[model samples]
Target: MIKTGLYFGSFNPIHVGHMAIANYMVEYTDIDQLWFVVSPQNPLKKKKTLLDDYHRLELVNRAIGDDLRFRASKVEFGLPKPSYTIDTLAYLSEKYPTHQFFILMGSDNLESIHKWKNADVLLANYDIIVYPRPGFNPESAEKYPRVQIANAPLMEISSTFIRDAIKEGKDIRHFLPYRSWDYLQQMNFYKK
Candidate 1:
């Protein structure tokens, strides 16, 4: 079975940090491919500046460009609101039975993953690959044998920082992936 890694994120604007992690996971690890699963907004809770689902997906596509090793997945778009990890995993597993799906997460996220919906079930069913993040450690990962901490390079960049910079009229072209910055600018997103 092809080993694929699913990197779930809102990708408010696909930044260099997100791209670097995906690239590292795909090229340096056993994962044959990585999918940037662009998370959709929970309709009940309206985030002030969160871009539209399709717009965010478009940014992810531009970030990934023509790389065959990476794909922008919208699996959660057709699913129920308040996307749950377990549900998405079940749906993806059923839809693509030929591929073995693994969850990619940051150390911070792993530390608090038990609080997630059906956390136990999700842990028992699929493997999780944790990458390093600033100010967080994956100490809790030891509790799950399927969870492996990877040595992906530390990326200090964050989409929130980029958004704030744009809103403040700061030039953040290089902070985003190729073509993504231009799109964000043209659409005047996050520049209130």
Candidate 2:
């Protein structure tokens, strides 16, 4: 069975930091492939600044262009408005029986994961590959049976910073994949 790692995020523009973590997970870890699971905005709350779901997915697709080991998943798009990890995992497992799926997340996120929906069930069932983030130490997460701390490089860049940079007319093209940057520019995203 293929070991698939699911990296869920808003991927506002799919920046270099996101790619770095994914590449490290696939190349350095036991994961055979990595999927960028683009998260749709919650319908309960109106987020005027967030781009359309399909557009974000398209950005992920472009960012992963020509990479055989990387894929973009829109599974959450058809699910509930505020899709939960447990539900998404259940759907993916039922749909793809041959692939062994695991969750990929940052050390920062791991700290607050206990508050997530069905956190116990998720932590108990799936393997979590945690990438270190600046200021957040995930060494304590090793206590969990399924949590594995990855020696992946610490990434500091954030999508929020990228968006703010774009709005400021900054040259942040190098922060994203070339194809993705082109698409983001063509679509005029993150710019007022």
Candidate 3:
């Protein structure tokens, strides 16, 4: 059976940190392939200045390129708003019955995961791969036995920080993937 890991995120702009976590998950975990599931909207977050969903998805694709092990998916775009992980997981399970699925997330997300829709079903069915986020510790995963904490290289870069730098006319070359950086510059994205 093919093992696949679903890494769901807003990825308003795909950055090096997001890529690092996805790379580490497949390299270090049992996951054979990692899909960066670009969410249209996160229920927990306030939708104010979110980048266009297609643009965000395109950025993720640019960052991932033709990596056979890594893929970009817009599974939630067809689904309802505040895309629930459980609902997506259920849909995927039925759609791809042959592939085993796992959820890849950051420690920060796990901190408030209990509040998610059908959190109990998600915990009961799928395995979770949690990586450390900047300012967030890994100890929080101890509470969830099904969670696997990854010791991947912790990158401090975040989309928010990258956006801020771009808006402020600061350099962000080092924070995003080279191709993504080039694409962003070519399109003049994130400039205030």
Candidate 4:
């Protein structure tokens, strides 16, 4: 069976930090492949800041490039809005019967996972790989036996910071992938 880890996020603009984490997961874990499931509308976040779904998807494709082990998925885009993890997982399972799916999340998300739809079903069915985030205690994950704390490099940068930088006329070249940066520049995204 294929060991596929699903890393779900809005990826308003796929940044270098996101790339680093994806690279780290493939190199350090038993996961055979990592799929970046770009969510159309994150249930926990406001939609006002999100770029168009297709734009964000194209950015993700550019960021991943020809990496064999890394993939960008638009599964949620085809699904209903306010996409829930449980629904995505179910859909993925049906579509890829030979793959064992896992959830890749940050400690911050794990801290409030209880608020997610069918959180218990998610935890009970699949393993969770939790990466560290500022102010988030990975130890909180100890209660869940299936949760593994990974020591990936912690980059303090966020997409919000990147968007704000673009709006403020700051250079954010070092924060994003080259191809993605080129597309963002060509499209003049996030400029006020």
Candidate 5:
């Protein structure tokens, strides 16, 4: 059976750090494919700086382009607004019954997992892979036995930083994938 790991996030713009974690998961874990599930809107976050959902999805596609093992999915776009992980997981479970699903997230998110809708259901149904984020502690996982911490490359890049650089007219050439950077420049994304 195929082992598919769902890396769900706002992915406001697919950055190198995100790719690094996905790459590391496939390399070190049992996940055969890592799908970037671009969320339409995160229930906990204010939509102040989020790019258009399709644009963000396009960025993810540009970042993952041609990588057979990596895929960009707009699964959340088709789901209800303020998308919850539990709903998405349930939907995917029925759609891809042959593949085993795992949730890929950062330790930062793990800290707030209790706030998610049906958080307990998510934990009970699927395995979770949490990666370290700057200023986020992995020790919190000790309290959650079902969560596994991944030893992925530690990068300090964040979409907030990237957006700030763009708004300030600074170069983000190194933060995003080359293709994504080129696409952003060509499309004038995040220039406002």
Candidate 6:
């Protein structure tokens, strides 16, 4: 069975940091494929600053363009609202029985993982690869055997910072992929 790493996120504006994490996962871990599962709606996050789901998905596809190991997924878009990771995982497992799924998350998410719906079941069922996040201490994750800390760099760059910078008319080309940056500029996204 192919080992697929499911990296779920809003990807409001898929950036270089994201690319770095995906690269790290594919190179350092046994994960065969890294699927960027673009969540249309995260139950924990506010939707005010989120871009359209299709647009976010397109940006992810453009950001990861031509990468054979990486894919942009819209699996959560068709699912019920306030998308919960547990439900999505179940659906993906059923649809792709040949693939063994692993959850790719950051230290920040690990900190509050207990609050996620059916968190215990998730922790018990699948492996979780935790990448570093700024200001987040990953010591708490050590309690779970399924959770492993990845060697990916701790990139302080975030989608919120990117959005705020764009709205302020600040240049964010350095933080984003060339194609995604160009798309943002052409579409006038994140500008208030």
Q: Each prediction's Cα lDDT score? A: 0.88, 0.89, 0.88, 0.93, 0.89, 0.93
Give one digit per residue, the lDDT tens place, for model 5 in 70-189: 998898899889899999988998998898999998887898999999998888778999988877777778877778888777888888888889989998698999989998899887
Q: CA lDDT of 189 in candidate 4? A: 98
Model 2 over residues 1-192: C-alpha lDDT tens digits?
Answer: 999999998898789999988999999999999999998964333567788889999999998989999999999999987878889999999999999998998887788788788899999999999988877666588679899899877778998899999999999999999998999889888889
Task: State the lDDT of candidate 1 residue by residue for 1-192, as single tens digits.
Answer: 999999998899889999888988988888999999988864333677789999999999998899999999999999998888889999999999999999999887787787888999999989999997877656767789899989888988888899899989999898998599989878999988
Report the candidate with higher lDDT, 2 versus 4: 4
Q: Candidate 3: which stretches are off by over 4 Å?
A: 134-139
- Which lDDT tens digits does candidate 6 get at residues 82-105? 899999999999999999999999
Assess every candidate by TM-score: 0.95, 0.95, 0.95, 0.98, 0.96, 0.97
For residue 47, give model 4's deviation from the true position in Å.
Answer: 0.5
The per-residue C-alpha lDDT of model 3 at residue 73 equals: 92
Which consecutive 10 residues in model 4 have the weakest lDDT in total? 134-143
Model 2: lowest-lDDT 10 consecutive positions: 41-50
TM-score of 1: 0.95
Off by more than 4 A, model 6: none
The best-first sequence of candidates by TM-score reads 4, 6, 5, 1, 2, 3
RMSD to truth, every model: 1.7, 1.7, 1.3, 0.7, 1.1, 0.9
Q: Which ranges in model 2 have alpha carbons more than 4 Å from their true place?
A: 42-46
